[model samples]
Target: MTTDIAVPKSAQSLEPFVAAGVFEPIDIHAAGSLARLITGLEPEIILGAALAMRAVREGHVCVLVDDAYADIDLSDNAKKLPWPTPEKWRSVLTASPAVRVVEPSETVVVAPGEALVPLVFDGVRIYLDRYYDYELKLADFLLDRSGSERINVDESEIEKTLDEIYGKLTGEIDYQREAVRRALTGRLTVIAGGPGTGKTFTINRLLKASRILDGGRPRAIALAAPTGKAAARMTEALSDGEIKATTLHRLLNITPQHPARFNADNPLPFDLVVVDEASMVQLALMTQLFTALSPNASVVLVGDPSQLASVEAGAVLGDIVTATTPDPDSGSVNVALADCTVTLKRNHRFSAESGIAELSQLVDAGETEAVLSCLRAGHDDVVWIDPSNPDDTARVEQETIAAATQVVNAARNGNAEEALEKSIEHNVVCATRYGKFGVHYWTDKIQNELLNTILDCGADRPWYAGRPIMITHNDYLNNLFNGDTGLVVSQSNSAQGLDELKVIFAQDGELRRFNSSQLGEHTTWWASTIHKTQGSEFDRVVVCLPEPPARVLARELLYTGITRARAHVSVVASEAALRMAIETPALRASGLVGHLRQSE
Candidate 1:
């Protein structure tokens, strides 16, 4: 006779078991034998395991295991078997550290949360604490691997390389020369600076110096960035076909179906790797990149730390820089950090007298009065558009449209081709929200109302000449990635009577046709949110600061948008909105620095 056992197969089925004092979701994979495992275990151990599982799953580095049990129940009829009281659970977790029945190797080690409990199982793989463990492991891995092969190059040698690449150092201190010298001395180097700080110049010199130090034996170098536009920019700066830049995803062989083709077991094949726009890289992604790197390979990270961080769950570059001791009271230098990090301060994009440069500094420092003064000043580099009615969103929209119209008339001069070229040169960045005062509103106003080009196809969202479109997804075959923007050169009806668009992306340099159907799911109008403009720049920038400042109007966002402008910046904002934006700084939660400090 066979006895039928009711197994919980679905999430709903597991719900009843959970309420009845069963394993948490963290152990859901082992749900089949959970009851059998619990049969002989003490009530306190069972309860403690559940709490420990939850904490680890929640990405906590460590938590007191004996803390209050909020989710589980200990009432008289809560379970059929005897359940441990909250006090008893705490007592079990709070006990002195003791060994479990399992061997040290077999035990899945966990910290304070469960105190002495090993939380072990015979065949179960011990899971690392999601982000915290990754952070700790990465920190130790980098420290162990870095400076293992410090290529010693004289200061004069570095100066010679810089002079060859770039004419001469402008400032009293040759920051570019110093950065190259630092890069050669460490396997892991971070080149951090704000906009127009000659980061590209420093990187080129570093590449040249690395070759010199290595006996000019053509070192294998790979350049990568978090996004396609950033990669394209890096490639453009290097102007080397043999050493072309690629997106991190493509470089790692990441696809929709898999995390990566390259990992710890199969590391990337390269002698030196340079990651541009490092600030946009997430911590998890950074960890993956590091894991895939060969032990002795040199790595360089370049970006502006003050720019908007990754949209995901990490402020990686900021965390890494902050981990280093800025000023030691004991006057002892943090050689590990100092040797591996270079902060570039000289601005090459703008002159010392430029208003855009002055405004960025003020915004970065969160100085409301200084920023306001800079914006209000009659400077040729800045065009301030203060709406008459601060409370009226409609008025702000109209005022912005008027400013955009003026820009169009000035740049276009009634030439169709010139209009298309000018549109790409200038970008209208909106505040981080989707409403009447955002990208959608401005895209419609600019495309439909302001510059009404005749539509070639009859569709819901018809394509017209000079319509700016941004790729929202990566298309490896087309060599396009998210944040890549283009203008519609032409449009027509396909054989299937579907609307087709031919877009020419600036990144491509040459005109490569893309069908509208191919872009339907991946394209968005060019009036972008501040986040999308992180790794891009334009000749002119028109920033639409929402009339009633939203919470998302972070100082970094405003500063990033402003800095995107190379020549001019037109701001459409009320005084109140501008002040709020300047005052509010973006805050991201991360613990990489804490881990780094603990390791130190």
Candidate 2:
């Protein structure tokens, strides 16, 4: 007959069995029997049965002897059991650190040279102390394998190569380099220089570096300027077919005729994008480009915020710069390549003595005029150029004609001959105009006359070769002609082109107007607005400062106008105009007199 027994929930009730040597070393078969007995005792006995089964399954112990061998010492009568002593016992517990025994009946079995205790299950294993030796040998083998497989890398050599490559790729680490690097690393880099700070040159270097790093031979890169003229400048720079650069509008496939259909879904094929003359780009247009490009692409935005005069009042680059805050998290991500900014400083085009550039730097630094003036006194040959009369169109026209004649003659006659013999270099001619309130009448007439003169003078000349002449005014259509040394008629007309010399025509307006492709080139003759000429320079300049109502000419504007001429400056204003300049609020505020006094 089969009998069933039950076990209790607590091990306290099993203490008697453990003390009686009935539960100390339980085997698989005995555990099965005990499980049956416990089922009759209580439902919770299932846990105890589970623990016993787990111990057996885990090979923690083995039952070598049964009830038949109760009177015999199991170690000595191990031959009758399935596993014999020593060798059999070692094999059984080889994988485990300890061994245990279980018996249903009260019997104590022992072997010589082994301490077998009854009712104490913890003292069963004698081989537990030897496991550490096996672990140490395994660890030493792993260490040997690791040491043999190690590779020696020359980190210093790698760093040297990187530094050399970077240095060769970029000429120097000036403010412009720092700015571009910062921008490349994902900061909004804003480069503002009056004129000829090598903005385009720096941008080209940046593009080359980015392209080399991109690995893929990208078909096209986004090249944008504020206007068509600026776009042309960028195109001229990339004479090689390797970099396919296009204006933002052309790249975006947008035109005035198709203004209603701006599609952001269709992206142009380009691995990297570079926007030159970025200041002129409207904020809305910028947003459209950002949305159109893939998130993984990289972009180089180059522009002078002060050159945003052509932009609408609300959509100015300065406004955009002011709106953007330096993100702390920028460049932290290892994968992102889209967001970066760079600011270019140091106007290589102008001499350090130029007050306009100096004053702008002061303003950018948030310094007062007095402080700016004090700084200006340390430099020599800094003069103020101002034009009186609101309607100085005639004077500007005369100055343009004279300047054109002088430049042409000077170029033909040689610099030293013109400077020493004719005293002609000193007669610098400039075009001046009224404020923004006045129509750009003088600028228009002067530009037209200049273009006509250049066309007529070289129309029959064999060297003309359709000498490209860039016009400041959009209506003039002078780009239709071709030439080597083209006249960058206006800031907007300035674009990347193969022009040996760039002649800028300036009109009194906002300073931002001059920051474009045309004006950013290495200018031969800077015929530009006094406002635009503030942070700029020229070889020879003729001032046409027109007398305006209510003394509209500021001291800074006058200072900017005069210092643009490097070797010579010709001021064509009445004595009254000069006197008004002495007392202008701009002059008083700048404390020019105090600085001059201090210098004296």
Candidate 3:
């Protein structure tokens, strides 16, 4: 028999427990009707009816209760009550010989003339045997009542499934994966790394992850870098259709020499702000950024302390972390400041064994000398190519033409195969003339000779005219002598769409003559002074250090020029220049002489 039960309005208060699926409502009044219907049956049958009625009420097949109900007094049992007191219900069930008392929530029925128990409840049936006395297996009893089947899977398949599930669960959704999770849960994180460690990569990841977790797209995200150049690079890397990134200066409209204008009244309009290249960020800038943040906004700063420009000043990232100490006067202010610090410690750009990489590590460890030692290892390849003074301009012209002819012959006869194998596809020959005093001139005598040689060798059939011969005077000049051959002189005449071999020539008078105009416009030019060559690198270099300067800066300039060559270098200098390089303290301290000795 089934009874319709009305759920109480108070059931809404039990939503938490109901959602947990641990309990169900029952009508105790209806259970008494089932008890009366089975009154005339055998005691075992009557007990089974009571168990079935309790199961239907509780939404489970097994009912567990205290054993105080075993001695129910049935003095008013003849009355058809809708609910029975424990005293009235227990007396009838315990008197039956077929009913066996077990543990709480357990009952056993014995069949006619058999030691085993046959249990019947509504449409369900259970058989019990007393092999181990009357002890009941709770799990087995639940399984019999639930009547669900089990399936087995292979070990490998199960392991693979678990791995995939874990990967999906732990995978990064957006840049906010860790930071936002921690923030929501109220935790602080620090992200730190050395040069090329993908600090910016982490910042972008955090931004993307946060957007995914927030359900809808974020209204705005702020991107910041310590310097204008770094911010520009990050903007380029992160630029897409939706996301916008800018340098801290541009975002805040602050100039390098001006006081910051950011404040609480005109706060940055973003839910999240990511700062890149944070190592270069000064405390002043950070203060401005913090003040301009929105009330509920989050900020992420990324940088490497070892690469900080102010390393000697001890304006390190660690100092910033330490300064976040709590102050009694400003409680929330200290908490907000502490919440923004995150450190990331992974190096992604260089291999762990690389010299530059090791140098970065040494700098981080505060070992400046070790960093200098790594720098003194010098370029990976340095070759010295020397051509003796073959006379002045007249002889140089002759020898230069001769060298061009030799190069053409080598190319035609496959003698330049080694350079070709090394991916050197073209060669440039630059020729210039020097007059007495300070007059300078360009003589394309060598270029014309090489052009003639290529024609004679049938190299012209493949079109060799587009090859660039970079002649540096003041500006770069470009010309297409034919549809095939192209010439680039100085920067003034440079064209955009072409790759050409660069030839550099330093006229003797030009070297002696210091005109700001003599510097090449388009192509690489031979510089007479070493100072101008600082921070420049070249595949091959020819240095003509004539009259050495008496000043210390001149020797330092010379050191700079010597270090520019990557694969090949030729030094044609007066003996005085060599003496200056050997004697100058700056040169010695730079360790050039020691480097040469080690190479020998």
Candidate 4:
């Protein structure tokens, strides 16, 4: 449908952008279905090894156990707990929740329409959602793939002024220039790069050339992000036109009432679909997008594969990069077909001399010791609290409290300079929710003592009129996203108080109103999770590194967490916790690796 594409290299660096993680190490499965719901714990579910294993392995009902049990620990339980024979395990699959001996019963009050015998029975936690495992779905999609047909574009048919784009964005680097060129030419291209490499800037230039690049075709360009805030950001970036911007889910109208119904042969309304944070797009979602897209419409996948993959299954962005990337080691596993990837090598967010910049480089290379030393070098980033003793958990908690208190005070105070420094100069981050120094603790401390919130959102969080509030979920229609920040101007609630409260978002000096239920999860508390805050940036960031009692995040998390700061960063953690986070290795879905190995 599109023209000659000199297969662009997938990654700039020779080093692998992704590492393979195993789903079902033993390649064995039955019929495949994509789009599974991998939600958090269902209030509290205590399932056992047999049931938990069945739910995850065979039943396609994934569980959300404590991260500490990264492994299900079925074997350990079998040895210690005098459970039934291993051969008889499958019986638990269909056993009723009420069946005491065979079923591992609980006295939980089931919610309407849910079969919740116990949210957590004997300490096994799981969620029950009828979603498909997209990892398996991706495998199915690849298995059905024919071969890649190299797209050839006639230069004679192309316009000559593509270089004019480079002139527009001042100081546009060679890598960016190359990426924009590829995006302009190819029908489907991946602008793969890391933080501050100017993926957004390149996309802006491309959006400007939508007409020139598409050969005078009516520009029905649509922009989408995996999350709401991202989509809102895209909407803002895209200049006024017939262009439509929305979250991928909202674009498909996939709400509770209207489930996604995409026909593979049917073409969509738009001529081009540009997706930001494409790495986060799950397999099932991608499949639907491809199936629903107009046969001739182009797709541009933009994101850094080095960051986290989709929360669901399959690293579609990385898989595509590897398949197209030229690796001597990429034999059958990393097939080269559509060379449609561009990786930005420069760091735009941080300068060379800055500690954060140096930290990012070291973390990317998986250099744990170097990162530790650099952080320990210590700057005036008073937020970087290093613990002297890992054994004393309370001390770390106190340190976190002190630092957060300082940040909250600086940010929420009426002083203009102090507020500027807090909002533009710094952000606070934590590894997980449950720890003493985690996001929950910081949010609570800020709320109970710091902000003096005036109204509750009718959701989980309270609304402070002037405090900077970051939207945690994508409510695209309402112009909210994972990173978009704004202030609460006023609260609107009906007299009965039964209805959802309407919180007006003061965005760019304009009031965009939304109901509290619609606002979803948000944090005025400033501190947030590392995972939630990805794809966003601040001038300065403070990382609250508490020793997680459970699963320690990998080094990439730290890399991403640190990179969020534009000017400075302070990490508060005991040496031991910090080391654990940095040393943890990342594993990609192997099913994707298997699919990518095929030659186009």
Candidate 5:
């Protein structure tokens, strides 16, 4: 199952070609070191530039606007890079959304892309500007010593208390017990764990401990998550009526009218706040959440450290949980303890023998080739469909269709004992929305070609009747949240019905109906972006890797996607494509991530 292919000419060096502080692999992006890798590939130049800029920003680098004349200045007054003489370069650079070349000042606070676009085009040497200001500020805030060591978490006390109150939870595992203990006593607590590790149950046990510590009086514990689906899950997990849950944005009501106004003067409604999936909450949002907390309030952040960081800024959850050595060199203060952090190592979600569980470990090890080899050998739960090539549009399309068809046919035939279960439990996923095996292409294929069971009204969106569907977006009114699976039993069939899909969702033991618009675009077959499925888990998963943009595939995305499945996982891709995604290391700017271990 393990074989090494010929090393690419451009990939001999382990160091990534960082342009304007953004990390990009040479073999895929600009062909290792030589800019000539883009000889005949002119169409991708503009797109490549944009991707480069985005990667840098996502890694927490500031690509601020500067004057074209002072682009290279290291001081406060910036200097711009020299303009390229090539006519093609000038034309494409001007058209990019990142650049504002027509402006008089030339560097008047433009988008981050503007600064990086020109550098990417010309193949100029990009100097690293370490944002020491923000790094120190973040470090100091996390390592605040306001009675941090004073807090005492007695494990025996917590366990005894839990058993006294929650007899059902008396036999909790060691990892869950430790997490609950930390959450009970630590002011700022983090429970870092993977899927099936009983995060919800652990949080519930903490809720029980909170009531016990508060002398049987209900504690005002507010729960919030980054997304609506996660928020809903947070609320549903706790049976206690005292706990109120919502999305972070809704809880803060952060409108333009109310700025970052989370001070002692403007106190929050609850005594404690627990945010789940804290990984997805950006630094900007986290800043507001952190500032809003009263000094007396307890904060609990729960997420997986190995998953992706926020789309906006700082790796808050991981940073807080990481063991940060006061980097005298980087102005990173040494912190002995980070508000009591614990990682649940045991996995109760996917069994140790399950293919998904194995795949997860392989991905964590960055062994893409091993995962591919294991996937190629089909099992009852896991199926691998090979394509002609990663770049062949026709082959990718056919493979996606074939895999989806197999799942559907299995469901209809009831051939496999768990076929119907798999239909509802299985989902198809991809990295991006663009290309042959993307969400739209596969969504259309499943609706019109594969199942072809529902009747379409032919409106703005063809609202089908009695068809299996998934909501792509959140609709609060209909209680139809994204990732909520349901059957489109009926619709208006009138003017009001245009662009709407009538879905009946199973809530609590009853069937509830909602006549909502295409809040979640229909795909008779199910598939979601890796980001969308972060906090969720499934029985089986199909990962479709089309010839996506090089920057889109990485260790974190592939690893996170593989970990979503509980029982089995099937990845549809060519061996070459698999190798590229696996072998290519997505390097993080050394300054962005703290080298702190998760358990620290």
Candidate 6:
């Protein structure tokens, strides 16, 4: 299987240099299915090419075959082949028509598929085939709107109508009016900002202005979010429940028949679609959403770019914002894209002079020292607890329990369910990771110590009365969705020796019973990670940070967790953790912007 190639003796230096740096090798056995897709490649290069392609699909730039034997699994017939050194990888990969080395180094190989444009990189790396297809498809879907006819509306008339609609709102109407104007003039609109920046308010006005422009006839508008909780919030924000919102999945009709019932062949039946909390929308989901839209339909994506990206993969909103953002010096950008983007700046949730607003600005700007200074200065809305110290460690747990004191006391006294529900709605505890200092530790402590309730059904999963659980996946039959919260009300053992539990969802008061064995342990969680708390708001938030800043403590995580609090934020972490959270930005490898620019 070894390729016949000649190498100069002078070039036989193994200094251990990689082309695009080192990347963690993927589990090749788990990716065996992809191996079948690769055809007409040398036996020696087949494993390497498949592993590299799988790595790219998993969000890595390249795959490294560092160790010849350990990095890959060899069959009985293949083990006889020579070890795949860097020189060997280069020569074999170069000879194969299925894969090629982008760099001179022999360590990296990428599959060049039909969807990708000519592979080129100065500082930017090629997205390979799988990621390249996603990026290229999404870019084409978004850019197709440029050729679609825009709404016919007079600028002065629309501006006057926008002013009238926004005048009823609290904040200044200048930004809102401008955003509405751009939205009406463009087929694709993106509204980016942080919390309290009036994105929802602006969207409401945009709908009103669009109706006004259409001679007072309401356009067919559909509202959606990435999660049910976010959709519920969006529904509550606009028109006081007049405009309903649904999850993007439900809107797309994603089912066993296909990933989406609606697609390019069968477009969505709406003239305008507004997606709120767009930050939580992953690249694949966004692509599905866009592909189903009618070419002439107007789309508005509203999200906070400073918040954490979607938990799965891809940064749709962040990439769009970065690509469309204009240069400060020359104000140069794609005119069509610039016209489609709007940044809301005014804060309505927090007062202009509030410390929470100041802290948020600092976090957004990556001013680590300034944030620490504010925390040290004792900001009224920002509470900092150093868990590294013994006293503060206890304080961190105490404060977390104190945040839910009302709910815990109500449960203990057997008080009215209404009051307990009200108390639970106002408080939340968030952790960066699910390890020692994360949600599992805090949830177990709260259930064991505070509630003093436990149920063992011969399974590792624990259940108890008054246990707070968040749904981790959408259950279509039960009408439960990811991000939905619930409380266990009752539990019992059936004659079949099965454990059953009754729970009440926050979305609805109906108590439902289900067997413990019916669902996986991961379907529910007692406490939530910070990423789970995205697009959610609570009056008070207790952020539990591990003593040592882990890789999960990124600037966006801290910002998203803190912004979830409306009244106050209590951060439980060491000083070093805060510094790490403030300094480190979340890194996501995506080529969305590259393809987006190519389309323009």
The digit string of per-residue lDDT tens for model 5 on 238-262 reads 7766565677876777544566445
TM-score of each predicted structure versus truth: 0.73, 0.43, 0.35, 0.67, 0.66, 0.78
Between 5 and 6, whose lDDT is larger? 6
Q: If the candidates were sorted by their lDDT against the true structure, best first, what order would they fall in?
A: 1, 6, 5, 4, 2, 3
lDDT of each: 0.66, 0.39, 0.37, 0.54, 0.55, 0.64
The TM-score between candidate 3 and the true structure equals 0.35
Deviation in Å, model 5, residue 103 alpha carbon: 33
Q: What lDDT would candidate 3 get against the real structure? A: 0.37
Better candidate number, 4 or 6, judged by lDDT:
6
Candidate 1, 1-600: lDDT as tens digits: 111234344323444446554454454444334434444444445443444444344332222332323223344555444445556644553441321332212212345575343443211112223544455456766666543654443657666766776668776777777777666655788889998899998788777766776677877888999999898888878744457788999999999889899998999998788999999998777888998988767788999989988876567787778766543443333356655778888898898789999999889999999888898788899877765656444554555555455434532333334545666576778885477558877777655665443333333655555556788877777778888876665344567675444666656344556766666445456588888988888887878787543656778888888989999988877888888888777655444554454444
- Which prediction has the highest TM-score against the true structure? 6
Worst 10 residues of 6 by lDDT: 11-20
Per-model C-alpha RMSD: 8.9, 34.2, 37.0, 13.9, 12.2, 8.1
Cα deviation at 347, candidate 3, in Å, is 2.3
lDDT of 2 by residue, 227-331 (tens): 554554566565444554445666776655574133446655554567776655643466466656543444556666543232221223443343233324441
Off by over 4 Å in 3: 1-180, 183-190, 239-241, 255-262, 309-318, 322-341, 368-600
List model 4 lDDT by residue over 155-188, tens digit each. 4333344555554444644876666566556556
Which residue runs does candidate 5 get wrong by more than 4 Å? 1-137, 145-159, 162-173, 239-244, 256-264, 321-335, 376-380, 389-424, 450-461, 466-487, 491-501, 504-514, 517-525, 585-600
lDDT of 5: 0.55
Best by lDDT: 1
Task: Write candidate 6's Cα lDDT for 1-600 as tens digits.
Answer: 122222222211211111112222232332233334444445445445334454444434334444333323345544554446666665665665544234321122234553332222212233344444455577776666644546554777766776677654455447767777777766788888888988988888877776777786667889999998788778767873445888999999996557799999999998888999998888878989998998778888999988988876578888888777654664544556656788989898888667778888898899988898887877788888776567876775666666455554443343336533644454545655466658777776655555432333323445544456667767777766778766555433567675344555544233345444444333334357888888778777777766543556778888888888888877777788888888888756665655555444
